[model samples]
Target: MPAFDLPRRLVAEALGTCLLVATVVGSGVMADTLTDDTALALLGNTLATGAILVVLITVFGPMSGAHFNPAVSLVFALKRDLPRRDLGFYVAAQIAGGIAGTMAAHLMFDLPVIEVSLKARTGGSQWFSEWVATFGLVGVILAGLRFDGKAIPWLVGLYITAAYWFTASTSFANPAVALARSLTNTFSGIRPLDLPGFVIAELLGALCALALMGWLLRQPANNTYSAARHS
Candidate 1:
């Protein structure tokens, strides 16, 4: 059972996601405005995202496990760590909070609150990148939980920081974040038309991670022959 009740947990999820998306979008906007070099702007955006993730997870992990992504929530539900009954509620909260975060960023930048993104981010390579990014993210999370739970924040933050540079899609591994980014026509935005492909790839990648990590993390049975020989 969770230390906090469902309502409080939901609040934590919503608030954490809200702040996370705000950082993502806001940082991208600020970086874009400050520099014309795409790589430098992306570096700035990545740093803020990775930094905020560490802070958000540390603050909210105890309350709601700090799953600000639907793919993450779904993976936990599949692992039976999170209640299946609450998965929908958690996803809803995450998506809502994510959209709100985009709007908040827009308001801060004096832009339209819900401008649909026209940034083209669709392609086979892009979809493949999403899969690879999400797969690594879920794998890292599960492995961190199995070994060093306390280090999960840093693990995830660093993984994403690296993934942003390594992946072709800039690693929009979170479905909620992908959807929210679709509503913004800023530096971080993705076209609404490209949303489904990213979301589907992310979900598939997460499930694949769950399957592989589930088997990999299980304890191996003792070998009777080896024990007998030692004896």
Candidate 2:
């Protein structure tokens, strides 16, 4: 197991989680009020999400690995960058922080119950569309992770921008993010009952990301930590 700067990691995770919820839920709620079209709401959520990912990665990558996604954290553990036992700690902190962040957003906005989630689901998308959108998201994250950390925020931003415009599902690939978004009852919400299906699709997308990274990065791919950029 690798040693971590625990205080730094926790603080970074807390800030990142808060911002993620704020961006998603805030934008979603605002967009719904600004426009009657659902497309406008999605556009707002997507743009806010992309911008936040870039900002969060730049700010928090040094302190806590900047893995706002549980799937990413788990995959990094599989790749030996993270300790197996520590997975529990990281995930617990992330989920708790995410929920807290969402709740705070709810308090701030006085959100309604129905409009508060970022979970993946069908509107016009079929299951395969959901799968492809998530795969695209994972694909972007894998590419970002396997490459220069300095480029991560921008690359991720570009990926998010692309995913939003290209995919039918609007690319909600993360469960924690979904859960936080779900808390706001805004344009980003998905029904609570539909969570399981979204989770399965996200995991599948993350698996695809791992495989794609394996083929794409193609270097011994084990415990390989190049110098990660902090800022």
Candidate 3:
């Protein structure tokens, strides 16, 4: 059984997600304000998000595994690390926290409480990019958990920072983040209409990674001859 209760874990997930999305949206807003250059704005957004991921994960990982993304939670649930019964609560908290974070960003910038994003992020390349980004994200998490658990925070943070530039959709690998970002007409926002594709791609990508990792991590068959020889 897990050390923390469901409610406490839920709170940690919510708070961590809220802070994470706030960092993403707020940084994007500030970056947009500070520069006309898209690359520079993206750089600022990437740095702020990456830095916050490291901090949030370090602080909240012990309590709830710091799964701010619903996709990540789903992966854990599939792996049976997270209770199947608790999956709904975790997803709810992540989505709610994501929305709240977007609202908080708007409030911080003196914008309206809610705004539908006009930014259209759709295309074959964009969808494919989301798939690749999410696949890499989950793959990194699974591999890191096996190899170097202590460095997961940095690994995730840095991976996201790099994915932001490499992926065409700027690597909104989290379903909740993609949905929440659709509410803001800012540098990091995506149109509501464009969100479904990204969400689907992300989910598929995560699922694929889980399946692949499961196969890859399986134990090798024991060799009867070798065992007899050793005996």
Candidate 4:
């Protein structure tokens, strides 16, 4: 139904990721400038990021499945919806797009194109928060596919909105996002040195979601294999 070649799909992925990160970093910078209250700044960032996600996903879902996050793409690849051969390319595109998005945001804010984040976000609590955030995100995505494919954009948007407040790390659940944020020394930025912990936690969370969803969505009479085979 959503017909598009790999080239088109790749382009869509890159473009969507770029816009998504731009929305994130740009909103954070603006919010911080407008308000001294941390909560208020986060609130603005959350709303803008969630709003942009809904728009981007709705617009690009047909074009490339709208996988702006590498973690999401990894989940789909594990589920076999995405080809193994394309996974590396997808991740590469997402990372590149993320950097480009950060640059765009910087340009808009009249800041340096690439400033390494000095804001330190690390430790057990932060790592655990990332795990939970990414886990919930992937879970929502998988569940949406089964129950309401049309509402996935809204579902993801809402989830991230909540996660931003609830999680200690402000839910930088996507590897590309975390990496790009490291390049921005702003309200939403994270230290580059802390990337490994967050990324590892995110990957673990995504894998856990895949395994759990596989079981949760298993056929009544048969295993998940039957459901996948039929789908």
Candidate 5:
């Protein structure tokens, strides 16, 4: 079957991103409330987020590469891989998805619209942390694409798992997630004031990944083009 068109892809990104943010952030808040210890909550949150991503990628990756993050799509565009015309569509979808997801989470969690708990950057080292976190995330995606993308889904899970701990900002590098998280002050909330900095950092990270992907994807003789054919 033919791949989904640009508009369809955007819709998928929007819906998928919304779900992703809701699950991740909601789990975090839920973890805080469980009678169980914080560790258990954290574990539950991580697993929930990871599992959802795997399913989302499997379901939507083929249609739109499941690029639930605007940074991811922009990176692909920078690489000349994505159709330039569709860039805006994908971004719009992701933004819409992010907001919608937060709205759903608010209702599900019984929290007001202003209480969404999103992960995000703060002052001081938090700025640098966002950049690094985004860099790592985009790197993972770009590198995965260079391969067969067979392990990408699994890798994404592992990546987020590690990112949750290692990065100072708790690795909330997803722009869609960030936007959705801003809607609430619950476990997933990231300060609205902090968003611009995060977005700038995320865009830079994606750009860096694009440069790396471009350089690495250069096939030698007989190697031909892998991504070209796939695209």
Candidate 6:
């Protein structure tokens, strides 16, 4: 059980997610405004998002495990690391916080508070990319927990940094963030219509990672290991 109460944990999750989404959207808007070069803008956005993930996870991990993504929360619940009953609440808090972050970013940039994105992000290739991105993210988290738990923040941050460049979808491995991004018709936005494919792909990816990592990280029984060692 966590040292923090449910309310406190929920607050941490919401606040962390809020700040994360704000950084993602704000940096993208700022970068787009400053440059006509699409790649440069994406690079700026990626750096800000990755840097903020490290900070947020470092600060909030102790409180709520810093799960700003529903896919991640679901994985923990499946692994029995998080209470199954709290899964819904955690996901709700994350999604609400993410939307608030989008609004906060819009306010900072003098844009409308709520706008439906028309950015076309649909396609089979992009859906597959989302699956790959989320699979890698969950795998990284699970492996980091297994070895070098203290380095989880850095591991996740660096993984996302690389994923942003390698994945076609810019590694929106987070379903909450993807949903929030749909509310902003800005540089970081994805079309609301395109969300279903991404969300399904991400969820499937996380589940697959959980299954694979569970088997890979399991320890052998004492007798089995002893016999194997002796033989």
Best by the lDDT measure? 6
Q: In model 3, which regions exceed 4 Å deviation? A: 221-231
**Least well predicted 10-residue stretch by lDDT in candidate 2:** 222-231
Candidate 1 clashes between residue pairs 3 or more apart in a chain or in different chains: none
Tens digits of per-residue lDDT, candidate 6, 56-107, equal 9999999999999999999999889999999999999999999999999999
Please write out the lDDT profile of model 1 over residues 67-135, one tens digit for every residue: 999999999998899999999999999999999999999999999999999999999999999999999
Ordered list by TM-score, greatest first? 6, 1, 3, 4, 5, 2
Off by over 4 Å in 4: 222-231
Name the better of 5 and 6 by lDDT: 6
Clashes of 3: 0
10 residues in a row with least lDDT, candidate 6: 1-10
lDDT of each: 0.96, 0.71, 0.94, 0.93, 0.78, 0.96
TM-score, each model? 0.97, 0.82, 0.95, 0.94, 0.87, 0.97
Candidate order by lDDT, decreasing, is 6, 1, 3, 4, 5, 2
Angstrom error of the Cα, residue 213, model 6: value is 0.4
Candidate 3's displacement at residue 211, Å, is 1.0
Flag regions of model 2 displaced more than 4 Å. Answer: 1-4, 112-120, 123-126, 220-231
| Residue 91's lDDT in candidate 6 | 100
Higher-ranked by lDDT: 3 or 4:
3
Candidate with the larger lDDT of 2 and 4: 4
